[model samples]
Target: MAKLTDMEELASKIIDKNVQSYMREALTCYMTGAYRATIVLSYIALFDDILAKLDVLAKVNKKAKKIYDEVSKKRGNQEVFESDLINQLSSNNLLTSLDSTFLDILRQLRNKAAHPSGHKPSAEEARFIYFESINRFLSKEILSTTQLADEILASTVNKNLFPSTDITTIAKVVRKELENIHPDTYPYLISKLIEKVPSSDGIVSKNTSFFITGLTFDNNDERIVSVVRRMLIEKKSQDEDYFTMIIRSITSNPIVLETVDDVTFKRLKVIIQERISEVDSTLEHSRFSHPVSMFSSMCGVLNDEVISNNFETEFSSAIEKFLYSSYLLNNLSKSEYAKEKYIEILMSKAGSSDFEVANKFARTCYTIIDELDVILTDQNAFKLIVNLLRAASWNAFGAKDLRNAKFQSMPAIRDKARALDLNDKSEAKKIYKEVFGTDTDYENLMGKYVR
Candidate 1:
């Protein structure tokens, strides 16, 4: 048996003053050899502490008070037993499963001492009750939801305080609390979880981030989904599996995806694509929104093999549309480096046996010259026009008059082309004559610009 003074010391630590006093009485009884009286007092003190916990829970859970009221109303003239209080708290979910089981054990011991069972507990059993009730239940205060949330935050805020096992325990606790649909504090808990994303250690932050995916919120109630979006944007994930986990979580959940607004979804899409693109630099460019620049970069940066596979596998039918996309083509024509890719794409199509696509590529290149200083200085641009002009079978200018836009822009093209510091001026001059030929258009061009 524990010493009498040791039992007194345990009683002194009880957080509730009333519970402490009752437990102190129980210790005094045990030290004086009143073992049955000691057991009764210990159970009374434990019961008082449980009542105090129920009172606190009542403030947040209206149902908590109802459970106690029902039990109290039924137990008229009878002292409320530990088993009754335990059942009410357990049924109402005011206590955890483990806690319910522990309380049941304490309740059975209390029954033996309260009702004169033929077998009375020895002084050792009475001492065990006194120590456990004072230290485990009464002395240790049960934290409110807000206090528990604060503890979780403190654990994750830095390395010195963060205990990995503690964090795991907190995660399960928070998840369970949320699962219980504790509306009064759920939003605050979610906010604390998300607030860790940018600042916490990556492993802890990622594990906390998983809380959103594990939750089930309403379609209209986007609080959890919004936090997830913020985590994806703000958290710099180092682990590929972590990144993949988050991406799959968001995309796979229909409710979450639907709840995310367009702007946020677009931003998330950009972040996800950027992460995926880390494997292939070519995939980093915008595929749909800025096709011209994307394709141009792909042409210049990625080798033929990568370009071929990506275009075949990823781009699919988009390849044809991207090649012929006017918005992208216009954007391409304005870029110095992109114009070369533009010319290459057009040349490739222009050389195809498909006459219609070939002719369209030629005419589009001619029309792109209307954009002042757009692509005219590029040798690839010059070569494309030369190849098109020399291929009479394509009949690129069949319906267009010499007085059309292409002819009208000849003087400007000539000036830009002539001023270019080409590595081979002779090749440049030959390219210049093939398209801006020495025909009547050139004599008229020389007359107009010779001054």
Candidate 2:
């Protein structure tokens, strides 16, 4: 055991030193394959060195009794380390599929890197793994530390999507917004936004990314960068119309707002409606120059051949505008449905063929369903989802034939629809069974209203 302990300690130090050397020599002005190979080998050496020492501790290598006494049994607390990482991630309480994938990949590699003789990864392979792992680990931390971007996104009610932007302002927004997320979604959403804004390219683009909103730092430190990023968001929010309203009740979010009551979210509805009124006033403004950015751009006539009944034009007029506008989305959609769509195009576009690289779309749908259910009970939202499912169903077939993607089966669309159905059905069953004895086909009753 003592021999093992000594081995691990020495190995950790060597790994740490080698990593620094590798980074400094391999990257930037010193970029070369030798440096890169050295970096990669350093990572492999970390694991290899540790395992080699442990092997000595084994009966095979001969564990010395006195040496074992000198070594302590407790290494760094694995639970504590993992918990801290998880806590930082969930601090803002939003996780998109991309964020989830980034975490999944990082943790998996970490395990591979830590285990004994874990398949003798090559130097180049080690570098590749390290390359990817570094981003996975740091992306959220970098963004959250930036903090300006989250402020901008959450403050979407007043500002244009790409308002005359700057890195300082972006960092400011991210810092401020982190306090608003419930910590659970923080890591996932933070990862998603940062990954989109390639930090590897340079500091300039990285700084710019924090401004785009939906981004944040992944740590608890309230450093100067964090504070400044927060300051920028608060300042920007203050400049916009209805700033006072959003500022007044930001702590009212259902997903863990500190020092606020649950009822505050209900009051937020009124604030949201007021913001909707504010957006109505901006329609004639000159800034909405992009053709697709217009509030009505994403909206379409719902050719619901099955509905047979016309959607109330009276209601549709107000609702239709709400569906497409980014400003109205956070409020009107009730769930993250609209917000997710906006992110989709922000990251990728139709005919662009750059599918979301980091997140599984289906998993994203599931998460939205889970989070939205906490606050929303609208039947209309469910119907809209059903319509979306239909679209996915049709597109799946076309995609299968055209691109030969394996996920083109009807099952994919059905899975999406079924996620909604299961939630709706379960909710219905509980309510109905509680009210009346037994249940008589719950999905049927719920679908009548939601479908």
Top model by TM-score, which number? 1
lDDT of 1: 0.52
Tens digit of per-residue lDDT, candidate 2, span 1-451: 1222332332333323544343434233113434334334443433333223332333221222222222222223322233233333334322334544555554455555455644443444445444433333221222122233344333433434334444245445555554434343444444444333333444433333433332322222333223323333222333333232232222111111222233443443343344445554445321222211222222221122211122123123334333233333333233243334443332232122323311233323342343333323333233333333323334533322322332233333334434556766665354445433455644553354333
Error of 1 at 181 (Å): 14
Span of 10 residues, lowest total lDDT, candidate 2:
249-258
Q: RMSD in Å for candidate 2, one decimal?
A: 23.9
Estimate every model's Cα lDDT from 0 to 1. 0.52, 0.34
Candidate closest to the true structure, highest lDDT: 1
Off by over 4 Å in 2: 1-22, 25-80, 87-91, 94-96, 134-141, 144-451
lDDT of 1 at 431: 55
Give the per-residue lDDT digits (tens) of candidate 1, residues 1-451: 5677787677778888877777777777887888888877877767767776766655545666676566556555576656777776666556656667867777787787778678678888888778767665787665223444444555543443323333244345445544324333456766666555444467656545444444432223455555544444234243343454444344323344333444554444444454444434343223321333344433433344443433333332333445544444544543344554455555556554465666565455445455524544556544543444444334545213222334344556544443442445566566546554544343343233321
